[model samples]
Target: MSGEPLKKAQESAAESPRALRDLIGYHLKRASAWDLHNANAALEAAGVRTVPMSVLLTITEKPGISSAEICRILRMQRANIVPVLAELEARGLFLREADPDDNRIQRLFPTAKGREEAQRMLGLISAHEERMLAGLTMAERDELRRMLAIIWREDGEG
Candidate 1:
């Protein structure tokens, strides 16, 4: 608590290998990997073959969102999404139907079974998110999220 020792502590803290920013980035990358692992495990437990979490998330959000929109929001190419879409469709998770309003557009929709699976997937996602945010206080978590969002936006990564 004395001035010199406190200053030395602060200096050491700043110089540590796990300084704040580096720690944050390190944990962020680790958490991303952990999320994917947990999601895959959860899917397996639910008797579902593993698929990309991105596809499951997109389908869950907009059951009938257009393929183009998925491509746009995820910043993915048609080539990347097509095979995944085909596999999901083949697995009876969803299907692409031409838009009645615009035949040129193909929209994704979860079948009845797909809807059920989506709900289960969401449960898994929620558990993973809860685990990820476990230690932070609510305010701290919110501030961290806000700060990260601002950083992303400023860097044109959002």
Candidate 2:
């Protein structure tokens, strides 16, 4: 094979299906990647990663909630959430205790430090979101959330 042909192929852009960019899945994946990158940066200052931030916030909002509920609400696996919960606990951000009514289950709650940290972290995250949605009006943002909720509802039905 001629080196010229090989070089041209190597320089070519990724070959994907036509209209890929127009697809909702493609846009969703790209938007998620961008948001994750920006969110992670803000999360780092709080001494935690994305998952831990989520866990902390959930605990703050629903104190004494069980780990099983957190897993269900986040649509995450036990194996994944276990480590994140451990990290948060180790950092003194939250605590886990055996449920009083159900001794078999463990409940999570944020400590005083956890609540303060979560408030700061949430502010940073909110700023990042505002920048990402800068082009959208308040009405548009509300409509977008409503549309996303519909998809999420269908997800549970399936």
Error of 2 at 33 (Å): 0.8
Give the per-residue lDDT digits (tens) of candidate 1, residues 43-151.
Answer: 6755653454567568867978987788877777878888878777877888778999999988788788777777877787678667656666688779988977785
Whole-model lDDT values for every prediction: 0.71, 0.81
Best candidate, TM-score-wise? 2
Q: Which stretches of candidate 1 lie over 4 Å from their true place?
A: 1-27, 47-51, 154-158
lDDT of 2 by residue, 39-101 (tens): 998777776667888888999999998888998888889889888887888889988789888
User: Whole-model lDDT, candidate 1?
Assistant: 0.71
Q: Which runs of model 2 end up more than 4 angstroms from their true locations? A: 1-17, 155-158
> Could you tell me how far off, in angstroms, the CA of residue 37 lies in candidate 1 after the best superposition?
3.4
Q: What is the lDDT of candidate 2?
A: 0.81
